[model samples]
Target: MDEIIQEDKKVFLYLNNLGDPSFDQLWMLISSTWIWVPLYIIFLYFLYKNYQLRSLVFILIFLALGATVSDQLANVFKYGVARLRPCHDPSLEHYMRIVKCGGQYGFYSAHASNTFFLASYLGILLKKKIKWFPYAIFVWAIVVSYSRIYLGVHFPIDVLVGAFAGSLLGVIFSVLAQKVINKQKITP
Candidate 1:
């Protein structure tokens, strides 16, 4: 396992250091939260105004669950696998941006996981009222995941896995919430 991780790190170092200025610039542009904050506010306002209080509460609970699950899963993978980040590996030392150096193991990105989870959970909840919500969520997830890679804090694979794991958790929570809502008989 250690040998495989080392080999993967070597490959990532070579690929991630392509040093394309345009790519870097694009990444920087997408990574800014100025765009995300407005979108978040709009979504929150819509949810608060359009949805019933119970539904809003359920969605918030599911969002929290998704975030918690993502965090715990990231910690488990980071410690259990013990893979080193590109910035931390001596072989990849020259390739790193240095400023974005993070923890030793970067197998899974918490940022990507958390953002993706929130996006997926909210996207599902808002799918009917806002037809474009899912697309926006997907775009947000992609941008967030790309930021992790562009900042030299995580490899592409790490972000991809984090996104996938987060999406799964979001779906699970959504389904559970639906079940609970259906089982309970609400009075009109």
Candidate 2:
């Protein structure tokens, strides 16, 4: 376990140090949640398109619940694992380009988990109607996840596990939401 973790750190340092100063602002923007507001608003359009007002409320509620679950789970892992954020890592401090340090623990990233949760939820919900939706969501998720590393806030493994866990949650919740849709006979 120690050896593997060391290797992971090596890989993380390599990736985290790749960003040039010129692109720091770009990565910073990508790592910020506020920058994604327009994209989220676009999601509102889809929800309105797919369901009547009542069902849209239910779907949005479930989506928010899924995101909440993803965030809480990530927080649990962070505290349980007690891993330091790359920016806060003494060993890694000299080796990486840290634009900004986040919280004390960063075993898994809530940002990655939350974003990927939305990606997975929206992907599954819109796949039937939008053939390219899933791919786009995953791409967006990846970019956002990588931005965490670029900002030196998380290791690659942190984001990877977050993505996987969130993806699983998304699948579970989306399936449940789908069952409800079917029962309600709500067609997109």
Candidate 3:
């Protein structure tokens, strides 16, 4: 486990060092929630388009709740694992170029968790309607996840675990959302 973890750090540093100052702002924007307003609006539009007002309300509420759960779960892992972020780690502090250092712990990134949670949720929700949509959603999730490492705040493993956790949470929540929809008898 220790050797594998050491290799993961090596991979993290390699990926983190791949960033250039010229593209920092672009990545920072991608990693930011504020910049994703349009995407959220689009999601709302899709929900509204597919369901009646009451069903939309239930879907939106559960979606938000699921996202919150995913984010909070990552936070728990961060504090529990107590792993220092790459930017905060002493051994590699000098070797990396970081634009945003962010919080002290980076065991599993909330950004990765939240984005992938929404992606997986929305992706699976809309999978039947749009044939190719789920792939696009997952691609978007991966790019956003990569942005965290580019900003030098998270390790590769951090994002990987986050992706996995968020994906699982997403599937779980989507199932819950489906149950709510079924109980409510929401027809798309």
Candidate 4:
């Protein structure tokens, strides 16, 4: 465990150090949830385009629930693991570039979890309707997840675990939502 943690720190440092001051603001913006509102709106538009009003409402409910689950699950892991964010780690202070700092714990990033959750959820929901969308949204999730490392707020392992958990939650929720849709005979 200790050796793996040490490797995590080393990898974190390598990724965090790749940042340049010139791109700090861009990464910080990318890290901000508010900055992605337009993209989220676009996602909503796509959802509306694909599903009927009733089905869309149900899908939206599942989306909200999945995102909440992903975020809360991350919180549980963060507090349970009690791992320190790179920005808040004393040993990493000297070696890392702190473009932005978040809370004390960042074992698994909520941002990564939530974004990946949305990506996986929407990607599944919209895959058939928009053939190219799944790939694009996954890329978006990856970039958003990477922004946490670039900003020195999370380790690579943190983001990786969050992405995995979020993806799993997404698949679960999407399956459940699809069942509801199928049972209701809600045609898109």
Say which candidate scores most in lDDT: 4
Report the C-alpha lDDT of model 1 over 73-112, residue by residue, as the tens digit: 9989998878777778777677666436778998787778
lDDT of candidate 3 at residue 126, scale 0 to 100: 84
Worst 10 residues of 2 by lDDT: 50-59
Kindly list the per-residue Cα lDDT of model 3 for residues 1-188, writing each as its tens digit.
98988998899889989899999999999999889899889878877776788777777887989998999999999999999999899988888888899889999989889888988888888888777878887898999999999999999999999999999999998888888888978776
- In lDDT terms, how accurate is model 4? 0.93
TM-scores for all candidates: the values are 0.81, 0.96, 0.96, 0.98
lDDT of 2 by residue, 60-153 (tens): 8889899889999999999999999988889887789989889999989898898889989889888887788889989999999999999999
Candidate 2 vs. truth: CA RMSD? 1.2
lDDT of 2 at 186: 74
Candidate 1 residue 95 C-alpha distance from true site, Å: 2.6
Name the 10 consecutive residues with the lowest summed lDDT in model 3: 46-55
TM-score computed on alpha carbons, candidate 3: 0.96
Model 1 misplaced stretches (Cα beyond 4 Å): 1-15, 18-38, 186-188
lDDT comparing candidate 2 with the true structure: 0.89
lDDT, candidate 4, residue 89? 94
Each model's lDDT: 0.74, 0.89, 0.88, 0.93
TM-score of 2: 0.96
* Candidate 3, position 36, lDDT: 85
Against the true structure, what is every candidate's RMSD?
3.2, 1.2, 1.1, 0.8
